[model samples]
Every structure is written in C-alpha cells, then in structure tokens.
Target: MSDKPKTPLLDKVSYPADLKGLSREELKQVADELRTEVIDAVSVTGGHLGAGLGVIELTVALHAVFDTPEDRLIWDVGHQAYPHKVLTGRRDRIRTLRQKNGLSGFTRRVESEYDPFGAAHSSTSISAGLGMAVGAQLSGKKRNVVAVIGDGAITAGMAYEAMNNAGAMDARLIVVLNDNDMSIAAPTGAMRAHLAKLVSGPTYRGLRHTAKQIAKALPPIFHEPARRAEEFTRGFFTGGTLFEELGFYYVGPIDGHNLDHLIPVLENVRDAEEGPILVHAITKKGKGYGPAEAAADKYHGVNKFNVITGAQAKAPSNAPSYTSVFAQSLITEAREDERIVAVTAAMPSGTGLDKFAEHFPTRTFDVGIAEQHAVTFAAGLACEGLKPFVAIYSTFLQRAYDQVVHDVALQGLPVRFAIDRAGHVGADGPTHAGNYDSAYLGAIPGMVLMAAGDEAELKHMVATAAAYDQGPIAFRYPRGDGLGVEMPERGLVLPIGKGRILREGSTVAILSYGTRLGEVLAAAERLAAFGLNPTIADARFMKPLDEVLIRRLAAEHEVLLTVEEGSIGGFSSHVATYLAANGLLDSGHLRFRPMMIGDRYAEQGSVDGMYGEDHLDRNGIVATVLRALGNEAEAMRILNAGRD
Candidate 1:
C-alpha cells in the first residue's frame, strides 16, 4: 500500500462534479494522475487494466461534459469502467476491487448511482441506453444518455439491432464507438480532430439542420438528390457512411486518448440537440502504460504484479490448469482425426483454443465476439461430417442458448462443446461465474453433459466426445488446476452414460458431478474422524445419468448427498428427478440432500472461499454429512471451523 502512486490532482476529485470547473489543462493533469492511480490499483488487485486505460480520457470527458447521476452513461462490457469507478466516489475502495466483500470487477447499479446499468458481458450498451433514453423521454426528464462501446463489442448483432431501433425511433442517445483495437480506418491526425470538432460543433449541425429544412421544402426529386449529395460529400471525407445509413449522425475518428481532442468534441456532442449520434474515437488499448501498450491481451486481465518491472505475480500450483489440459487433450484427439476442428467465440486463449490453434492453425476458427454465430457456424461444420469443437466460457455459452438448441441439440448435431470455467470464477464475480450452464444445457433434449472430476477424467471426456457421434455432447471443467492425480499418456475413450465409484462405504454416499470430487474425497477423509465412512462416486454425466448406479447407491446407503459446483437446476436437480421418478423418495428409509450453489448469487472471493461460503467445499461437505447423520452439533462445529 505504501508503494502506491501519488495522485495529487486525483486526490482533489471526490466525484465527477469535482471535475466541472477544472480547466482543460487541469483536467489533463487529473487524467494523468487518474491513470497512475488505476495502474497502481490494478498492480495490487489484478483485473481488466488495458480497456480501462484506453478510456481514461473518454471517461473523464463524459463525466465532465455531462451529468452522470442524472444523465445516464452505460459502459458496454464494464471492463473499461474502472477509471469511471475511481472518478465516481469509489476511489477509497479502489484497491479492494475484485476482492472479498469489496468493489465488483464490473459496473453494478447497487454499487453506485453513477452506474445506471450493470454489465460484465459485452455489446448490450446501445440497447440499454436506448431503453434509458426512452424512459427519460416518457418521464419528461431531460438527460443525455451515452453508450460507450468498444469496436469489438459493436460487432455483435445485438448492437446493430439496438442501433437500428434507436435510429428508427430517432431517440436521443449518444453511441461513442471506442475503436481501440479493431482498425476501422486510420487517418487520425490534426485534420481528423478539427473535422471531428467542426462537425460536432453548433455551426455545422445548425447549417445541416437548415439545409434539411430547405431540402424538405424543395420538389421531391430535387430534395432526394440534394440529401444524397450532402451524405456522399461527408462520407467521402469521413468513413461514417455505414453509421449514417443506420440513422445516426457520425462524427470523429478523433484521437480518444488526447484530452484536448476528446473533451471539446464530447462537450459539443453534449450541448447539441441531436437524436441518435455516433462518435468514433480512436484510442489504444493500453494508452499510457508501456507494458500494456506493448501487449494488449496480457494486460487485458492480470494477476497482481510488480509495477516497476511489469511482472505479474504467479500463484504456484502443482498441477496444470484445466484450460491447458483441455487444450492438450483436444490436440491429442485432433492429431489422430483430420476431421476434428475447433471454434472459439473471441476467447481463443481463455478457452484454450489458442494452444489448439498452434497445433492446428487452419482447423481452428476464432469468430469474433459472436457466440450465436459461432454456434451456428460449428453446426454447419458438423453437418458436413467434420467434428467441430466449440470451446467457449460457460457464461458466454449462455448467449448462444437458442443456437445450441435449434442448430445443434434439436437437429442432433455432433458438436463437441469444451466448456471452460464451469464453476465460480473467483474474483471475476457472479457475472462471470459458470453457474447456470449445467442447468441450461442439461434442460436441452438429446444433449449429453459431462463434468470432469480431475484432469485425467477431462482427458477421458475429450476422447469420449471425439469418439461419440450420436448427438451434441458437452464437458465442463473449472478454471483452476487439476488434482495432481496421475496424468494419462493419451486420452482414453470411456463409455457414455456411465460413472465410476472412487471409494466404498455403507451408511452414507457422496455423489460428485464435477471437480468437486476432490473436496468430496477430502470430506470423506475428515468424516472418518466423526466415525462416518461415506461412499464417494463420481457421476461424470449429469445428462443420461447412470441410473443403475443411482438405484444401487440409493438402495445401499441410508443417506445420499449430491454435490456440484453449478446452480440448483443442474446435476443435483437431475439426480433428484431420477430418484423421485423411481420411488426412491417414497420409502422413508433413505434421506437425500442435494448441495449446490445457493438460490442467490454469491459474492466474489477466492475459488475456495466462495465454495466454502456456499458450503460446497471439503469442510462444507463434512458439515453436511454430519448434519445429515443427525450430528447437528458436530456439523455446526465443522462448518464454523474454516468459515471467516
């Protein structure tokens, strides 16, 4: 904490209102100090650094030019809003970002009134801002609504759909296209800045408005030609023809990082009485920081690091990560099978496809930020007899649920889904958690869902998915390391709808669906201290569950517990439905308890901390067993032992 940067100017700014009277030069100093503070904060508590750095000037400009608490400002993924958070009265909690009981990694309405809409996922800003703009119009409350979306986010169909509707209605909304990475077009210089200011200024807008009125008064044929002429003239100079066609007045390609260039144009756009406007600002992903600027993706999300050397802190672990294991396993399958190909929705690295791409470059496809399109594209590949592995994060896969249903599951396409981050994603918080995928995917008909109990099991699952060509099959794995169990030389293809028992017992049975098998085993070891020897079984498949094993376990054990790292309606729900349908519940001899993520969203913490808090960890499992065995006192003791 003592090593934190000194932000003298930023210290004076308590809120966006503090930026109101500051001159352009003073605002520039504030921006510089703000960037340092953000860098220092993220150096301690790692999170999205590059995007936030890119929008430092723009965030300052928006807050300074418009009233944020009243005038709504919606950030498209909220990854770029860290600077906005610092300027909007959350400066004190800046270091606690993404920590337990601390500030969220993204925007949350409950966290601050300045944050009107919450988002961790991308490309919903335009739609949300339009809704807010229409709501303000209906309430007779005049407020400037701005949706700052990145170029990558703008590629999604939802952004266009929202833009089309906003244009059609002529709603008063500002869509600031933060073109940081995707080179839309260069030509950014003094001339570009001047033109941006000129168009956004009152003189040009007034002249254009007068010309529109005159054009309306002319004969129909003449008016149509005159409008086309004016549009063409501007389109030739500025590459805004596409945005203009979508019913928005386009301005800029202006330098976004420059406070001088950004502030005035934002001020002009703020004062202008325009309905739907698009301001194209050219910024760098990691504007000020040298390391971040050099490599964009590395700094996009980071671990705590040494600020001076730009070296990140690496948590030492014995086992390889699930992502890496998945990548290697998929590569093993693809090596033998020429038809095996991979698809990723923007997350080539995060989903482990980048490694797969290294081995099979042409076979891997990175569909930029469009999960819906990626799913359908994979379906098309599957239709042609080629095996398409759509590797996507669990939270992101939810976006393409319809495509997963219609194009793949309903059609019974053999699309192998390698779902990473299948459980709570630690500090990234609830929005990024892979809690609902199990529930969502399990509900689809003809869908086969499997979870890995260990890295070895993940290998087997990958082989199984590759060998099976019956229907759509998915395998879920967590974000962290494997159990350090023995690694297989090559993956083995296991039978479908089958599970294996890890340990044997008599009175109690613990059926695990995912990586929580490690915890279940740990719980069994601890349960021995309480004179309770629980049977541990790894139910790899949630869908097409091993009914024979379930019936036998239910018959043999007095008490049964189902554990998973997913939401309520997932593995546990399926298990309960089977037991209920088979009259396992009618006979009062057996007691069944399903442990899952609670009905509410758990707060962000370490993966272990979050799981322990939700009572799904080893200690939690031990507590549950004792309680189920009528040892309530011992259960409470075990529960409180590790709890903070």
Candidate 2:
C-alpha cells in the first residue's frame, strides 16, 4: 500500500453524526478528504473507483442532511457507495474491499446497518425504498426512505415501475437520480439549481399548497389547468416532466459537485411532507481524480494500481480471453452471414460486443440495462429471420428468464444466447458468479444447451448456435482466458447432443462439462499414478443428456462421475436423471457421483481458490475420484493437503 494522505477533517469524523455538527464549509473539507480516501483505498483494493469519486459530495450531503439507519438509505447498484462505506464506520477495512472474507465491492445488508438494502445489480433501489416507506407508514413509524439511482440505472423499466407505484400510493419516498454519465437532464447550471431549490424549498411548496386550497374552492374545471400550469412551469425549468408525469415532484438538474446546492435541496426533500419527490443531481464520474476522469469508463472497475502514476497493475496473459475469442469468432461468422447481429444489456465492452460494433456498427444493439427487452428484441429480430446473439453474463441473464422462456423458447425462435462469465467469477463475489445459466435454461423444453470445454470448443459452440435455427439455443463460456489450447482455423458445427471421450479407461468414467474439462484431464493423469486410470469425456450439451456416451461410460466402467462448474439441477442433474431412469444406478455394481458447485454462494477470491474451496478444482476432482474408487484414506489425504 502507498503512504496515506493527510486528512485532518476526515480524522475527526467517524460517522454521519459527526458531520451533523460541522459547518457547511467544514463538511466540504470532509467531502474533499473523503474523495482522497476513496481514491487511495481503491488504488490498493482496486474495485469501483469512478462511482465513489463521482458521488463524494452527494454522499456527504445526504448523510449530513438525513438520519441514516433509521431513515433507510439505499444505493442503487451500490457502485457509488464507497464513500458511504467509509463514512459508515468501515474505514478501517476500506482497503480490504472485494477481498475474500472482507468488505464487498457492492452494498451488502449484513455488512453494515447503514446499508438498509444490499445491491449489486442495477435499478432496484426505488422499489425497495417504496416498500420500506409504505411499511413504515403502516407501522405508524415516522421514518424516511431514500433510494439513490444512477442515470444508467434509471433507463431500466423497473425504476419507472417503482416510480409509478410510489406516485399512485402517495408514499413518502425520495428518489435521487444521480446523473453521472447519461445526463438525464443535461443542463446543470446556476439557473437549474435555483429552480430546483425553489421547487423543493419550504416557501415555494407552502405557496403552492395555499394556491391549491384556494383553487379547490373554485370551479372543478379550473383545477386541472391550475395543476398543469404549476407542474409545467416547474418542469419547464427542471426538465423533469417525465418524472413529474410518473407522479413524483421533480426537483432539479442540480450540480452534484456543489455542496451549497445539494445540502439545501436535500434538506428540503427531508423536511417536505410530500408523497414522493425526485431529486436530479448531475455529477461528473471520476470527479476529483485526473487519471480516472481521463479514462473511458473513468476507471469504473479497476485492478490495483500505483497511486502516483495512476498506472493499473495488470497480469500478463499468454492466451486470448474467452470474450475476445467469442467477439472475433462472431465477427468472422457475421462476415459470412450478413443476417447475424449482436445485442448486449448495457455491457458492450464487458461482453466483447464493442469489438463487434467496430466492424458491424449497424448490427450491434446496446439495450441499456434492460436484459428483458434485450431478449425479446432479439426474439423480434429472429422473427424476421435475422440471427441474433444475445450476449449476457450468467447472473444478469436471470433478469430476463421470463422473456427467455415465454418470448424465445415458447415461440421456438432461433435467438442464440452467448452466455459469458459462465461460472465462478472471482473478486466480484457470489453476486457476479455465473453458476445458474445451465440449470435455468436447461429446464425449458426445446432449449439446447452447450458449455465450452475449452476456447476451441467455445468457437465450435458459437458456430453451432449460429447454424441451428430450429429452436432457442445457448452456449456458455467462463470468465477468463481459455485452456491455451490450439485454436481451430474456423469453428465447426458439432452434431447436436453428443459428447467426445478425451481418454479411455476401465475402472471409472469422468463425464465433464464446461471449462472443468482441463481439471478433469489433470485428475485423470493423477489417477494414473494411483494405478486407477479414469476415462475422461467432455459433455458438450447438457440438455440432450448425451445418452449414448453416458450409457457407454456407465456400461464400461464400474464407477461413473459427472463434473461441472454449476450447482444443482444443471449438467450433473440431467446425467443423473438419465442414468437413474435407464436403471444405471440400480446396477449395484456401478457407483455414481456428481460433482458440482456447493449449494451456497462462493465468496470473492481467486477463481482457482474458490474452485478448490468448493472441491471443484483439479485436486478436488482427484479427491472425488479417489473416494469413488474406495481409496478413502488417499482421498482424505488429498483433500486435507489441498485445503491447507
């Protein structure tokens, strides 16, 4: 870690209550100090940087203006909550961000009382906050609920739904739309700030309330025009007509960096008796840091780096990443088939669609944070006979399962799902783990599922998905570099529902799925030293069950094992179900075991370490095979040594 920066004001403040006694100027000093602290801590920890930097002032203003823990503060996506974390008595462990057994990169409910709601995915804050607000009112408790959502997150339909509900219910809730990148209201100047302050201020509200009472005594026809005139006048200046239409009292395009503007408006929002109020604060992502500000994503997510030079420390890679391979192979396929198109849910670069966009700008669609829409949009495209590859992370894909089943699978549309980050993503923790795609997608009838055993296999699956148009198909690949295997000149479309044996053996058979094939091969070699050589086979498609190969393995070997980097009801479940129904398990001579991710969320750490923890690593596979062979002592020895 680098030398700590001098933070005099920050040293005096340990919690939000400490800020309550300070002058506005002194609070500004705290915000400045807090910004420095976030930058320094992120340089060592390497998590979300720009978001924390962007909301430094707003974080201070909100905490200072409100009574948290009782008021209920929720940060949408939790990316902008680093400064909140620091001020909430987690400063000692701030440097341990995203580490295993340490602070989470996103808000975790168990981590702190100040964090009322945990969040990692986007656009859920408002709904949660409204629920809290309504609950508090029902309980006869005088408490405030505040949900801070980002501009990018606001694009999601969930946010709008929550706003509409809150408006109809007349819940006393506050939604702060933090406009950092998308500039929901682009104009953020003195005029906007003045109008925002005016709308939220006590004087303006009191006068408006009086006018409503006087208008109430007038004719019924005049009421609508009076209300429209008041709203239009305010919306004209604030540019928050949409929010107003949703039943919220829209406040501002206030400069988020200015404490003078933020404090007063937030104070007004706190004091107001209104049902629901929306505060629009415009902020610059990576505000105080020059290097981050200059970055394309403002260092939204980063690796550990030198604090002085802003040079991020990255590990050198000898092999190409799975995402890059997918991107290139898709580009290659698209070049041949002009009907091919790509879609991403606000993750162009993360899904490698940015590279595809460069070549085929017209073919790529970025459906901002709306995975549900992305799925159905691809379904619509496929209806026109256009090949649409919806590339989404395994975790984020959960958001669109309804659409996948109803819109794509039910309709038998040929929408190809490019499932990235297939299993056990490190550092981002369980929230980002790609462990359920196989299980969820496998359940739907006519849904063909394939997991890449290696980068080369990934290419084949991509080609296979593109070629097949009978029904909805999905191909999953892991989060990092592939097995460093030889790449095929061009991907070949494999026959549907078949698996290939990598090695042949007599005693036991190991049926592998996804990138775990590399580990399976290693375990097979290890078993060779034990004088119990095991056969290894890669099950390319999980849904089809590979009955022929599975039956062969069950028939040839005394023991059979299924291995995949997924949890229950995935590859192993399908194999077990097939084998059991065929009377394989009742043989009494052939023993079977399925190795999968444990029935719990894995903490953030090295992917290899997490795999080892779950007994899914090379050593884990070896141990499982040993125990299956009835070499109990040897299996225990290997397991103990691996853990130690």
Backbone clashes under 3 angstroms, per model: 0, 0
Off by over 4 Å in 1: none
- In terms of lDDT, model 2 sits at 0.91
lDDT assessment of candidate 1: 0.92
Clashes by residue pair, model 1: none
lDDT (10s digit) by residue, model 1, range 1-644? 57677888899999999999999999999999999999999998999999999999999989999987889999988989999999999999999999999999999999999999998899999999999999989988888999999938988889999998998875779999999985686747899899899988999999999999999999898987888898898888777999988999999889998878988898898888877999999889988999999989888899998878899999899999999999998999999999999999889888889899999999999988899999999999999999999999999999999999999999999999999998999999989999999999989999999999999999999999999999999999999899999999888888889999999998999999999998899989998887888899999999899999999999999999999999989999999999999899998999999999888887899988888888999999888888888999988987877775
Please identify model 2 stretches exceeding 4 Å from their true place. none
What's the CA error at residue 555 for candidate 1, in Å? 1.1
CA shift of 536, model 2, Å: 0.8
Q: State the weakest 10-residue window (summed lDDT) of model 1.
A: 180-189
* Model 2 per-residue lDDT at 395: 96
RMSD of each: 1.2, 1.1
